[model samples]
Target: MRELTFENVTVRFGSRRRGTVAVDDVSLRVPAGQVVGLVGESGSGKSTLARAAVGLAPLASGRISPAPHERHVQMVFQDPYSALDPRMSVGESIAEAGRRAVDVAGLLELVGLPGDRAGDRPHLLSGGQRQRVALARALAGDPEVIIADEITSALDVSIQGAVLNVVRELQRRMNLTMLFISHNLAVVRYVSDIVAVMKDGRIVEYGPVDEVLGDPRHEYTRELLAAVPRPAH
Candidate 1:
């Protein structure tokens, strides 16, 4: 188990004077073998942070330990349809990211996908299945840290739980360190050991999952909690 850390991380787009700061001096940690959920509304820099971790976004300042070149990190993107290649079979895609002689079937099974589905192309799978395939590919690389960036947002509500279950189960079974990013407080509460609330480009509140959710200190967090759908008796 490897702990992932961000030290005063920042990200910007376009020119320095004219560019917008997507993430601002954000420092958070995902402890080894634990899940840290990053929750915020859209345009809150949640996705940008994830992208920076995976080296997809250029960092203007600060550092992310276990850099992408070290191959200790892998990211599962939000859009399942676009995450995988249209031309490659799911198995091939997994193999492409994996070290030599990867067990494509086993990785599929790890994500609750059948071994036989390996031959299916991205178009042949349902949205949930494609997301599962993406998860499998991430695992094939044997990453120490996994960044799940709003992975369930694009899926049907009925299937979101299924995907989340796979994620939580895998994290526990593998003792994986993960950063689970989402806008849904309920979803974050369901899977996180710790929670960080972001508004604008900075984290406004962060603490243990139950503490932060049950007794939020930040006004933004309270508003987000209020927006959550309460169960009907």
Candidate 2:
């Protein structure tokens, strides 16, 4: 079952980044029950493509289709700082997910946070905490698929491992179809079963993660692989 499909999608933005296109005539299908990593440089349009898939951004051309019946869909943003309401108590916020037909407590636990963590506010929590809260909210909707847009970008290195592991474990336990977008090839390789490389807004290469990451055919992809900055711990 194809969970999401971007058919001949094109999106362009009037930006100062020369030769940069958001997404250019890219066609992609993320199959059901797998994680797909969308990778590119800062302006590679990976995020733009993800946003379009989730109906957050409109396409300049082409079609975006969600899974049939759409049990639910969630987005875990890269920047946890701006994704949530500072004033809203996590419990209140999560409880609101009741509107999405999910149980708030179950959502919190599913993200690996204690159910009580739901009562805290974004500002009261650490960076990882905030991100988990956001995840809980996203899951609160009991989504069948999630569009994770750099959801771990703000966490500490140690925390990143924990969160990544949580996501990996949950994906299997719950059968989630994940679209993980990032600039880091390492993270992409870690979480993705399939990989898609975007360059100047177009999908230059795509295939199984090991195949594309281990044997990249595009110069841009090789350059991206080479430029990955290792963490200084």
Maximum-TM-score candidate? 1
Provide TM-scores for the models.
Answer: 0.98, 0.89
lDDT of 2 by residue, 1-233 (tens): 23877899987666546534578899987889899999987887888887776677667789877732454667888998887888888888776765545566777787777887767778878888778878777777767788899888777887998888888888888788888888888899999999988888888998999999899998988999989887799
Candidate lDDT (C-alpha), each: 0.95, 0.81
lDDT of 1 at 168: 95
Model 1, position 89, has a per-residue lDDT of: 92
What is the TM-score (0 to 1) of candidate 1? 0.98
- lDDT (10s digit) by residue, model 1, range 33-53: 999999999999999999999
For each of the candidates, give the backbone clash count.
0, 2
- Model 1 off-target regions past 4 Å? none
- Model 2 alpha-carbon drift over 4 Å, by segment: 14-21, 67-71, 229-233
Q: Pick the candidate with the highest lDDT.
A: 1
Model 1 steric clash total? 0
